[model samples]
Target: MTPFIELFTPVSIRGMTVKNRVVMPSMLTHMASVNGEVTDRLAAYYAERAKGGAGLIFPEATAVDDSGLSYFRGLSIAHDRYVPGLKKLARAIHEHGSRAGIQLGHGGRYAQPEFSRSARRLVSYLPGISPEEDARVMDKEEIERLAGCFVQAAERAAQAGFDMVEIHGAHGYLIGSFLSPFTNRRTDEWGGSFENRMRFAEVVIRGIRRRLGPDFPLSFRLSSDEFLPGGITVDLAAKIAAYVVHCGVDLVHVSAGMIDTNRFTGPPPVLPMGWNADNAAVIRKALEGTNALVTVAGRIHDGDTAERILREGKADLVSIGRALIADPWLPHKLETGQLKKITPCLSCNEGCVGSIGKNRPLSCAVNPRVGFEQRPARHVENARKVVIVGAGVAGMEAALTAARLGHAITLLEKDSRLGGLVNIAALPPHKDIFLRLIDHMSHELVENGVKLVLGNAVSAADLKAMAPDVIIVATGSRPVIPGFLKNSSAMTAADVLSGCPTGQKTLVLGGGLVGAETAEFLAAQGKEVAVLEMRDEIAPDMQGRARAFLMEELSARHVKLMTGLEVRSVDGNGVVIVKDRYGNEYPLPRYDTLVAAMGYRSEQSLCAELTREGMRFVAIGDCVKADKIMAAVHQGYHAAKAI
Candidate 1:
């Protein structure tokens, strides 16, 4: 039996019906036509999503007029001249069994200064609202032109074979100005009273209905709650929804907090998850029993959670933006009950969030083939005897990726088990999220048919004897020490994390993430702990939010951290240290347990020997350089592709 997914069911609004509940909503792709027509690249990009199994493809907000363009060259639907290209786009989506829709947007006063019609844009024509503050103001005559532009755009959508059309009313856009009281404070008919403020959106909806008639479905996306102090509330959004549904909208798509309000509209919950679904429930509860369907989005990962939401009737459909981007084949994989085979969304935000903001292509950190569907899948040049010498994150990723390319792979490990060192790195009190990647990649190696020789011993001679076409040496690295063996009593960060053996009063030696985190873990276990680093600050390389949170936790837990302290020597007594940032030798804290996380050194003996032999080989992951898992996984992916 197929596992249930609320996100997998079909949705029909008006005459338009989609195959699945998954809707790839409009996202601003900086790709556009030079003269505001749909370019082939833009067409191919959306087609990739359609082929990946999206039931509906809403192309990025296309400007209805030249003045409405937000980017250098955005897709436009204002002119009849653009219909041929739009028709081709609709045809491409229909070929994949997905209904195509285009969003009709007018930048209005929200148009950027670089793209503004003049230095001033209309914020609102009403008193107390200035056009320059938000956008160029629309005069009475200008409003008629803009309304006509939308009507003509709807006619164009019908001609282009688009099944439905959505008016861009959310995210502080053109119609948004008329909906938001903060932006629209006019006493006129188009502003002031809630009913009056909604007039512009109502007019735009009426214009779309007039152009497409009642049979064609039309949906309106709402901000739900603006998230700002003075913005609209849930009760108000529901009232607006009821009013609009009566005005002829077919669906109510609920999304919370956009660029202007929350400023963090990532497709998924970036780290701490489940914020979006709560907001979705609120919007859905308000619109319960209306003929109009309710849809919600934001970080809806894992098929089970999505299915439960649908089964419980919390939402009619769940918009999975990042999950779909990560694996376009997610729906097909779920239907076939190949759950384990599905590449889980790591929620790293490396590909989806970073790519969208940087104006680069979309992709996923766990899945390397993301966003490059246009490029042919990377395959092995020929079946070659390949020997992998480590089984950590880097080693495993490289082996599995290469194995999938049809290479004969033999993974060798010296230790009795796999996960060299990383098993220790995974023990942090707050590193649960990072640790999950280790599990994911390890599973991938076995499922992809890579041969695991865990206990086997392999030297350089054994590698040559195997006559491998290529050798990827991932022997990893050794912890950095001021003096090796002499400081044997001082455990490395790796050993301390594993908790194999340690004393009660522990002094961690490094203020970076590893040392700080180890101190946290040990302290939480009721072991008195202090951290000493030669640098003035800790977690300097950490991201802003995580660094702030870790710092707060360290302070609250009373984990003593001493920076700019230089260590002397270690003996049975403990670590002898000094305050040497300015060369002063003041005595630092001494302890019963001294943990050294000064860092790691490359295990280059095997890598060096293999490189010197003039052999066809690749040295990747920590074996090349010791760093975070992101680097390790990234290098492993590229290295395997290169082979």
Candidate 2:
């Protein structure tokens, strides 16, 4: 018996029946060739999700016209030459009993000029903060031409054997630019009045309908709320949703925010789960009389929430993005009543969204085998004894990987608990999502038959006693304290998170991710906190969406953030004096405790001690280098596999 019956039930749009309500919505991977051709890596990525039990899979937004290309490696459907690659992608998804779909998009004024090499087309002349902001205002002829491009793209999608094609009218793209009053200021037929503003989308939709006939499934992705002043509100978006359904759209996929407010588009952990469900419900209500099904996407990561949305008629389907990236097998696991086995997406945004923004291929912090789906790990036929020290993410992941390959594994941790640094990382506000990763990985380790020994520190003698064939050390890291404050009463951020006592007023040094988060934690505890950094910005190493929300939270809590300043000296009484970049000395506000969150140093002591006894072991995670979780996890999995 499958769980979450509503999610696994079949649903039909136009004549296409999707096996379930779990939709893998379009998300950029940047896995295509530089010239916009589909690559084997991209196909394999989509195929994995389909095999994982998704009802329908929509590939990332494909450009309808070359002049509207947004990403350098974005997929394209502008010309017939691209049909073969798109066909292969569709076949890959179809082979796994999943319906394949593609989103057709044109970036409009948001298209990167470097790659497009053409003036961006806009509904009206938007005022520029600089001269380069001037874009080409589309004339009536140009509008018709672009509408034809959309129709051609839909035709190509049908020819490539895709089950459906979703028109990308959300996220401040070409169609969204014309629909939103905030960007469309023209008095022409394409803008001004609500009906006029929606003309472009209607034209494109009607054109596709005429070309593909009434039997083909068509989905319109609508931005239910622009979240901007003078933008399309819920009421307005509902009317537009009705209009689009009337204009021949079989489904309305509701999303939120525009390009300027993209943080809400791919929301990080700071945002609420299923944040856009309410707006999607509004659209569903508006389409009450139409044969249009609604799908909602935005930070939704769980079966309970997806089930509730469908049960309450908030939406007919849930389009999950980042969650599927973290674990493609999520839907399959949920269906088989293995919810606990599903690897939860941390909503960290450091991997999928952050990596693509940096022009790198998509990846997940919790799941290392994201982009490299084509290369599957091989199981070893001859099992060997493997001993792993530390039960942190790296160590646990290595243990599970090796154990699954038929290796006899034993995992040891000095601390009573698992998770290592992640246990402390989850202490900050809205960061409890990370605890899910810890829970999932730990459970998986046990299920894979990896022997777990906690509250015992591994020594060289222990390795010799066990006589393991392979040894892995993932002892993690320790906080770095400045030399001048090493002997003082200064405590590390880890100390505070570990329930160490602090005074009413606290000063946190090092305004990086750890320091800012520590400041937030202290403020929440009713402590008047301040963070001082020698750099110009706080949390510079953090991802964009998470950093933005952290700054907002700090300001709201009245936590002082002093940048371009360093600790000059501290008197015997612990009264600290600070200096700015200009060498101006000043006394800080009264504070009883000072916490050092400067950074962390790799815990390499164990590796060296083991070497002295002629024990060869591979070090992973912070024990190798004090970096992000991705590096640690990747190193651990690959290192264990090689052995």
Candidate 3:
């Protein structure tokens, strides 16, 4: 029997039958051509997940009209010229034994001005926020035209052999904006009353149904709660779900939060698993008598949780988004009882969501081969003896990759434990999910027969004696201790996170990710903490949902955050002196502990030593340059492949 029996069970939505309950919801990949044409890379990306055994796959959101293009490389169904490429994409999924679905959307007030024909396809007037808000309200005729765009897009999807098409009505897009009371501030027939506010979505749904006929499956994505004062709440969302089902929607994809409340979208681990299950239950109940199926997705990472969601009748299906990016073979693993082999999604958002937000190709921290699915890792004809120093993400990944390619791999770490910096990183509040990644890698290394030599520092003599064909230096990095704190009794952020004792009132002297996280960790332990940074904003390096959630956590804990203040020196009484940007010095409040989290410096001594010995070695991760985990993992993967 399958491990996650309910999750692996086949399910049908409308007339379309899926192999299993696992559905891959649409996520932006930015792999399309600049002209909105599907590229081979995009096709390969979707094909991979489909091949990995996802029952149903939705490849990102596609634009219905040129005026609604949000991403620079987003797919478009506005013209017939795009049909050939789309047909190829659908065929790729079909060949992989998965049903293909495409999500149709119009960005409206959220469309980027640079990529769109017009930046103002809003439902109503929303003041200056971005170029998306500078718009004229759509007239009755304009509304009809927008509905026609949806109809045509659905027609094109059917023509391209797609199994189904999902209407992207969530996340503050064109249709969602109209359905939301927070943005649909209108008195016309298209807004105001409940029925009026839902008119636009109804129009799009009915138009697509009419064009595609009743047989073609249609799914409507909705935000069960926009998380605003007067926005779409659970009550309103249930009603809306029922209404859409009545209008011929075959499935209701339940999601929560909008662009404004984006911290809930692709949420970090700070949030509970299956965070949107309750909202989905409400919507599912609302559509109880209807034929429409319901799917819930929001941080639903594991197969066990997905099975429970199905067993409890919260949703007819489960949509795995970011987790699939981390490991596309999750469904296959569950079915084959290879639970331990499945790589866990850290939900760090530093890779997939964060990278996509910055208009870059989507990548995953745990899995580096995200966009380059076309190029699979192949075993080399000649297997070399590979020695890796450092058992962090970088070295571990390198050893795993090389061992998989039939190389004799030995991973050495100075510390007794695996996951060098990752051990300390996972110590922060709500960040324990990171440990799952290291745990998975460690298991893989052992399973693949890679020799693990922990608590052993490899010296020059040791390397020469081993006489390895290739060496990967992944020494990682060390925390930067401020000049003033060098001689003082201040602790490093790593030291504190690694279980070093902290005082009653601790002062953290950096407002970056490390500092802010350290402050939260301390405050959670009932210790009073304050953070000071030279920059105006805290956690500048961090962005999107992670930073938003961190800020909220910091505020709730009453952690004092001071910015734009540089450390000057330590006074005679041991009180730390800080100076504002204006050069005015001030003595800080008394604190028992001061942690220096200024940043990190690369530990490149091993690389220098190798060069001095006239030995060649590939240095990856922080040993080359101190950066985020994504960079280190990616470098390790590619460096091993190169060897």
Error of 1 at 155 (Å): 3.6
Which lDDT values do the candidates have, in the order given?
0.73, 0.89, 0.89
lDDT of 3 by residue, 21-70 (tens): 99899989999999899999999999999988999999889999988898
What's model 2's TM-score? 0.97
Candidate 2 residue 54 Cα shift, in angstroms, is 0.6
Where is the poorest 10-residue window by lDDT in model 3?
Answer: 128-137
Q: In each prediction, how many residue pairs overlap at the backbone (N, C-alpha, C within less than 3 A)?
A: 11, 0, 0
Off by over 4 Å in 2: 129-134
TM-score of each predicted structure versus truth: 0.80, 0.97, 0.98
lDDT digits (tens) for residues 109-199 of candidate 2: 8888777777788877767611255367889999999999999999999999998999999988899989988889999888888899999
Q: Give candidate 2's whole-model lDDT.
A: 0.89
Which of 1 and 2 is ahead in TM-score?
A: 2
Clashing pairs in 3: none
Best by TM-score: 3
Q: Which ten residues in a row have the lowest lDDT in candidate 1?
A: 262-271
What is the C-alpha local distance difference test score of candidate 1? 0.73
